[model samples]
Target: MSDAQTQKVLDHIDADFDNSLQRLFALLRIKSISADPAFAGDCKAAADHLAGDIASLGFDARVRPTAGHPAVVAKSNGKGNGGGARPHVLFYGHYDVQPVDPLNLWHRPPFEPVVTDHADGRKIIVARGAEDDKGQLMTFIEACRAWKSATGSLPLDITFLIEGEEEVGSKNFAPFLAANKDELKADYALVCDTGMWDPNTPAITTSLRGLVYDEVRIKAARRDLHSGLFGGAARNPIRVLTYILGGLFDENGHITIPGFYDGVKDLPPDILAQWKKLNLTPETFLKPVGLSIPAGEKGRLLIEQVSSRPTCSINGIVGGYTGEGSKTVIPAEASAKISFRLVEGQDPAKIRKAFRDYVTARIPGDCKVEFGDHSMAPAIALPWDMKALSAAKKALTEEWGREAVLFGSGGSIPVVADFKKTLGLESLLVGFGLDDDNIHSPNEKYDLKSFHKGIRSWARILAELAALPR
Candidate 1:
């Protein structure tokens, strides 16, 4: 296809932008919360809805069953394995969303998708899944729709692997991939579940932090005791737990876990220089959330502390509680949820063992500590010199009229590792989400400009990919 032909498809995307938004809104209305079992039927409904929607655009689509929630697989190939002449690309996204707890924080209903004005006057799409995998995924689908509508077919062989179990750690989706690896094979994968640098600046995630989640429980005395009778005489599990977990951090905000940073390394000097120029000050990042401190390692840039360094966090803790008033009792047990965000070269199993060792040594003779493993995965770093990366950078730069920033994301997408391990395929992560999108939080939104320009950006990228040498 010529450049002019791609331009025609871009023009179509611009002209039919409203219908594209309507399609996205339709998908967003489905309550596919995979974490909660009550929404199981809704998760299947979401898969069916997305399969039909993709089938409408001239692909063979199906809602395949998994051990848990269902997944949708759609393919657009003209014949004989998509003619075997053009490059094959697989696009991955998720239809499931985070559970909408604390619903009172939302300005409107979580499932009622609507375009509204931001406090600063920018138009935004407000809903639970907006700017997450749902809204970001549609950008690629809408681009494909434009290409098919304008010129009869996509520039390359396209396959879509949309799952309904991402937010729940994708425990079942990896097995689903193994069951269908032969069918999902492609030259490369495109993942649209990441974020841009800022609202105006586009970015492609080059590296991702790994994750190790643990649930620790400390048990002592075997029963609750009245504080009046057992005060300072009996063991308090909560105090012991808090004391140990609190010591996980020290005066300089460094994780006190031994050998936690053994494999972690600093970014190269060239990349460090580039990050310094970006200048992600606390005033711009932290101030929005009523904070003014970079709470990670001391003497590191805010960007490094967030995106490149290893750290640990206590996500939740619970021991004893009263319904409304005060309960003066010494609890027999206490537990806390801990997570470690690991950088490149760190080992998840090693980190998990180290954490357990650190906690076990501190347990008193009267107490026992039990751990429940939740998740563990190592980090991913894509080489910066891939030809597809160049194509995407050029295409994003053209759409945003500014250079696209390439940086490591502090978040983890474990499926990226699965894609590599299972299919032997590398993934290119691109999306238009912003830091303030509140994805997984209340009042989540997707900037209207991101939705519109994101479609156009993918349209150009598809053309560029098709033109690259195989």
Candidate 2:
């Protein structure tokens, strides 16, 4: 665990990186698109292949069945190096890539992995799941490989929990975790599905927003009524539905639900000051997405609005309509799908109840409202001073030659919360993905540097983590 020892492992990583790329390419070639039933065999193949590969590195690895795609669970105890005293860590990632729809947009076949030069002259590995997960996950696996080859064992006990259903909402993954809870115990988890701050700056995601999704239907009449006859007398469900949803946010963009923001709190002053230095602006973060304004709470910084604030969004709405042209009719029912992104300290159940209450309060007595619960998950917030977090920051800084940044992600990784719920484990979210990786899009690529140096970074991180006092 000394610096010289870490450097030796890093040197081994550098020397064997070409073989690492070849290994990643082999995994990418399996076409493990978990969402498409046509690729079910490929998903199994990817699981078998990855499990076999991990098992070769002195792990007790297997492809375990789930309700959906099978998951790979691999375990190692450093071959007696720990003697049960080393801190146990779990590493999580996914093997399944998004489907290659609109395949013509890709310059090359989506399944054909290749090393190519970007327009900016940087080398990239282009393939499905390149930067999204497969490539990023391999960085850690290769690091372990390097350490095993160099020192004949890893620095700490490790477990790998790679799944095939992440891109498909991980519906079966939580159940799998519950069933295998006793076998997957760990002090903490390391997830490799997020992005760095920028191409050159590493980052640790310390918080993730939770989610509540609901579908509501407003039924005003027993049957569709002709608007020509019911225009003034009968109630129009679409009109009623739109009116309620339109008022969900005030002019200043704060959600108008009662008690919605009751538990929300501002970031600490020190963290706020650091974020101010980040200077995230509309031109920098929004312009590329064809936007010029921050649309959350008016007074908060753009960074806070997007990454730290809770938000409500109307994902879709539908009512009576015409196939080819407008029909003069008052729809019997209108439905809307809504979701809320929740931050730490906010209870998803409470927020969902508040939203339902708000909607029900405005429902006319003549109209019947039916609610359909879709999904709900609580937010995740890691301690700012966790020992593993500090070790990861140091490891990344040493490998990247820049201070590692920490930030809150507006999005939710439900598995992170599931780990906490099922195994009493917190997760450290880290990765080498960049902003332009185009994951879930055509021509997805991982920076060659992200692959090579990412391996070295993990090698250093494992060493640093092992040296921490128990």
Give the best candidate by TM-score: 2
Clashing pairs in 1: none
lDDT of 1 by residue, 25-126 (tens): 999999999999999999999999989989999999888988888888898973313337788888999999999999999999999999999999999999
lDDT of 2 at 189: 90
Q: How close is candidate 2 to the true structure, as a TM-score?
A: 0.97
Clashes of each: 0, 0
Please, what is the TM-score per model?
0.90, 0.97
Task: Tell me the lDDT of candidate 1.
Answer: 0.91
lDDT of 1 at 452: 96
Inter-residue clash pairs, candidate 2: none
* lDDT tens readout by residue for model 2, 73-157: 9989633222378878899999998998889999999999999999999999999999989999999999999999999999989
TM-score (C-alpha) between model 1 and the true structure: 0.90
